[model samples]
Target: MGCDGGTIPKRHELVKGPKKVEKVDKNAELAAKWKYCALSQEKLRRPIVACELGRLYNKDAVIEYLLDKSAERPNVEVVAHIRGMKDVKVLNLTDNPAWEGERRNAKGDCYEDMHCAMFICPVVGLEMNGKHKFCYLQTCGCVFSDRALREVKTEICHKCGDPFQDEDIVVLNGSKEELEKLQKTMEERRAKAKTGKKSKKSKGVETVSKPSEAKVSSESKPGLTNGESGGDSSSSDSVPGPSSSSKTAKPITAAGSKRSIQQMEEKSEAYKSLFTSHSSAKRTKDQLSNWVTHTPYHF
Candidate 1:
């Protein structure tokens, strides 16, 4: 379709035979998919004109096409085009490390969920002859670009020098300083990584070391000690009664034979005399001699 006062030939007019029919089918399928997706999402709305170019194109191919076709094309405009353009909740283009020019940037670690729905912050774009040929912008899941706002006009792409006009293009942008900073930061992180300084600390972790055990009470308790070095006083206190070996002992009796209380008393006296030591006997005898007269007839 011709626009901007140019007597341009129709898309089919440029093709011949099966090529023309193939282009028509591709365009028709793209249009149908775009419309269907739009109707399904009521609140988010849809682009007035949606196309399915990405279906037949990979990201690298799409980028190369934009750069080549738009090069040498006069008045070229760069528009924002989304990949996987189904009910897109967020633009996951940032997840592509190849486009970001750095591995860290590709991770998309700093972005929020809504960040994807916002402007194409990373600005995926076509770099041509050391200068950016196009830029893409997005807001509220709506993709746009500087070229899209401009009047439609054919322009030669800066790189390939091909005749082209820009509409609904996806261009990413990043300044040299921003890229350099990102690169330096990534390097710094890499250096730190080599040292193995980073650690994964959990929520309750205050300091990483063996935790001290709870203190033992002054009063003895099972399975604990009171800090004394006497082989653990708890050991002697809890020792079970003598093992089975000590349980086989004979019983003791008050007398040699079953006797009256007087006989038992005489036996006890004899046993005491036999068991008493000579020193104790001498002491008892001296005390008895002092307390009693030599005539012991009174006894």
Candidate 2:
């Protein structure tokens, strides 16, 4: 068959192979985690703090989040568990001796050290550059590699010499399983502390209530007796029987010979009007003057 001006296509152009996947650089990933803040994703600076969950963050970023949580942020979920400044501990990291930060830049160095670390483990000579697993002590804020702790096992802290348990050790940038385990331990410790406080409060309440209950019972008995006696006396006085009526009819005289000053005043003309014996009577001049001045006036 005779073909026109069009030519046939090659087999390689017609048939396509699988797409190649882009590989992530391990050095960059490790540097990002260890050398940058987890919350702000900025280069790690001084005053670095770590949360209870072992996540590193910048102190200024944490303070800003605390001041106004509603402010817009890049990664807000990273610090959701941080309630206040108390939730994080200021880390005391050791500076690496080999790090020439400003000098290296001024020299225009072409060599990039992948193993160079910003902070080094005091226990072992391991760099915190993400190749080895690292952890921090919550009690003393000391950072150490997992291998160092496993090799030299001790109950006290390697730096501070403070005693600590397994619960005090928290892994930095840990995997999902490690974080879950740490969370479980933290919750259990808090529950134990809460239960202890509740037990103490309950005991104090019981001790206090027992004495008050006893006092109330003891006082109520005397009050009830006094009330009953008073009621009986009042009831007897209310009934106008022969004996009760005669007793009430008798005049009460506290003293036998001495007369009260009120009896002397009752015989006076000024007090006689008080009993309604005289009506529409005007007071004399002497009485009016004495009433106005409240003292006798000399003529």
Best by TM-score: 2
Q: Which ten residues in a row have the lowest lDDT in candidate 1?
A: 247-256
Task: List where candidate 2 sits over 4 angstroms from the true fold.
Answer: 1-22, 193-211, 224-299
Q: For candidate 1, write residues 95-202 as lDDT tens digits.
A: 223333224355566752211121222333322211222232222223333443343333543323344434323342334564455346445645776565444354
- State each candidate's clash count: 19, 0
Candidate number of the best lDDT: 2
Candidates in order, TM-scores: namely 0.18, 0.65
lDDT by candidate, in order shown: 0.35, 0.79
Question: Can you list the residue pairs that collide in candidate 2?
Answer: none
lDDT per residue, candidate 2, 183-265, as tens digits?
A: 78767876898899999999999999999999887555433432465765586578976997554333223212556434665
After superposition, the stretches of candidate 1 with alpha carbons farther than 4 Å from their true spots are 1-178, 188-197, 201-299
